[model samples]
Target: MHPRAGQTKKRTRIQAKNEAKILEAALDIFATFGFRGTTIDQIAQKAEMSKPNLLYYFRRKEDIYISVLERTLDEWLTPLTELDPDGDPIEEIGKYTSLKLKMSQNDPTASRLFANEILHGAPMIEHVLKGSLKNLVDEKAAVIHHWVKAGKLTKVDPYHLIFMIWATTQHYADFKIQMRAILGDDVDQPDYYEKAGQTISTVFFEGIKPR
Candidate 1:
């Protein structure tokens, strides 16, 4: 989905690697400086490539920015997409919660990048938010509804439940500085996220488990 079109041929290993490198550098730049503050030259420098070489893969800064956001969105949604309706509702939700927290712990940059995009009105990725994201969330919400009706969960708004999970899990990434300030550097430790997942699951399941 990167490299200016027109080739109509499969990318070589080198081409694929170069594109990945560009996206990786662009993510760091965009996440730190944001879209407006970031520039093609900055990404090229970050990638340790000449500007011309970088442009060979991505013609415009906007192209690189959109690609990064698209990739991040796919990754950010993967945990929810994995939720299985056929599984035990509480267990499934707990697994989803843990996976989401793991993502924040492992790749907080991606989470912050995405959160910043939304804060600015998601000007670049609104279509995706409306289409693919909406469809996926709706499908999962229906699954949650099914669980509730089947007496697996207490009556609750599926959309809000999903939103609550997102808010709570993502807080570790979006407000990491605040977290680190209050909780200290231990916030970066694996056990911290594990404990967070356990605490969140306990609180959520306690409220939602069929009473």
Candidate 2:
């Protein structure tokens, strides 16, 4: 089960602190090595705790990985899930694009970890992808469809639009090496994410604006 919010039950401050440390370390390790490549020993070491102590909080590697993934997905989906059906469609899309780009800049590793899972066929997160993620996407897709039908947006495939946004926004984080190689020093500049957001928003909204 996911250890999100209330699901984890009550814990003392010390327990919470240790759990947070473990998850943070696990995220770094798992993001770098992925599921198969990562070992419990590595996570324990990164967390600066004994293996048995770490095991006291999380029993298995899979458990830790799933918990990390669940938290990551929940964080990643916040902006998407917040897309308001009542707001201006174009502006909403722009906001979502901006938020996603910011996330790429702020938390690249989580994006890479999620990408790594998908690249490996998403064996670990297949259920959430098919169930909760799909459901949320479908819900938003329908909203987009309504906007198009109402002449708020140009006719476009709602699902593919969302996919394009995901692909374009995440490229900065997932392919930072290639981006850095190509853009050189510019990629490290403070305005990189803002510029990326503008570029992606242009690509997505330019054609889709009601003509």
Candidate 1 TM-score over all chains jointly:
0.91
Q: Global CA lDDT of candidate 1, please?
A: 0.89
Please state the error at residue 28 of candidate 1 in Å.
Answer: 1.7
Q: Per-residue lDDT of 98-131 in model 1, one digit per residue for the tens?
A: 8888888888889889888888899998998999
Residue pairs of candidate 1 with colliding backbone atoms? none
Cα lDDT of candidate 2 equals 0.90
Instruction: Kindly report which residue stretches of model 2 are placed more than 4 angstroms away from their true locations once superposed.
Output: 1-10, 207-211
Q: Which parts of model 1 are misplaced by more than 4 Å?
A: 1-7, 207-211
Instruction: Return the lDDT, model 1, position 8.
Output: 83
